[model samples]
Target: MAGKSQAGGERIEHPFDPLFNEYSRVLILGSFPSVRSREQNFYYGHPRNRFWKVMATILNCPQPQTVEAKRALILEHHLALWDSVAECEISGSSDSSIRGVRPNDLSIILKKCDIRRIYCNGRKSYDIYRRYIEERTGREAVLLPSTSPANARCGTEELINRWSVITKDLQSQK
Candidate 1:
């Protein structure tokens, strides 16, 4: 249950959209976007969040400094985005409290694409995916450290280190 925000003087719909396509080789899953993300209408729009920065750095892509550019960067890299839950009853955006979670129909991707890898953006995504859909797909997933600033237990350098593995695959393709 979410209320329309009066901030920014605009109405927002679908605060967080999992970005992905059939051709997408990588999938970035965020638990859910914050109110600010909904208001801005983009993924990881929060300046402090490092998902884009970490991925861009890993891929050696020009760091996307703006929201539109970030979208372009992901598409340019052939990555797809989709939340683990297709629909859920959530109080605010906290992943811990998401209830009645229903996973998005992934058959579209399975039928149309050659998804080489399914990388959950963080542990929450991985946990949900593993419980809800992984067995059905019968594919192993790689759990990347959460890029959310909320996960301050780990340092940025450490996060970058874990993320380098994903980058290495892209480099090897070259």
Candidate 2:
């Protein structure tokens, strides 16, 4: 949504809009975009990220290979996606390197969508939300194990199991 800056080798702004709609029933938050995501201008663009795979497995849908397909999969299933840090100085895509955080305004999506549940993609996102957005939104986000490749300790099947919680929300919407 804004220009990217590499000053001090830290990203200064979020590069894309949050994905959501009036009918969206669930909101998923990541801490921030990875370098690959920024380059592709989409969420979880890294090939090794297990987000797409875990989503497909839990939703019982085909893995989305294109940005358009990814959007379709999320929107069609009443899920919304966005990041917690709107502006941050970080070294590459390392969440631990993030600092000077300016959290996103979730009301932009919350006002438009009937989101019933909020899910954080990892501990970083959960921590950020709890620290910055939770008081403002008055909603607690469920922490899900990260699907990032860096989280090798949690395999895809385990991620699928943990992420399966969202399906109940989605199914209830139907």
Q: Compose the digit string of candidate 1's lDDT tens values, residues 1-174.
A: 343333322222344555656556766666656556766877876777787778887778778887778878877777777667666655555566666667766666766656677778788778988998888888878888888777888777888789888766655544
Predicted model with the maximum TM-score:
2
Cα deviation of 27, candidate 2, in Å: 0.2
- CA RMSD per model (angstroms): 4.6, 2.1
Q: What is the TM-score of each candidate against the true structure?
A: 0.82, 0.95
- Model 2 residue 85 CA deviation (Å) reads 0.6
Q: Provide the clashing-pair count of each candidate structure.
A: 6, 1
For model 2, how does the per-residue alpha-carbon lDDT over 1-174 read when each residue is reduced to its tens digit? 343455555656999999998889999999999999999999999999999999999999999999999999999999999999999888889998888789999999999978889999999999999999999999999999999999989999899999999998788778
Candidate 1 Cα errors over 4 Å, as ranges: 1-18
Query: Which ranges in model 2 have alpha carbons more than 4 Å from their true place?
Result: 1-8
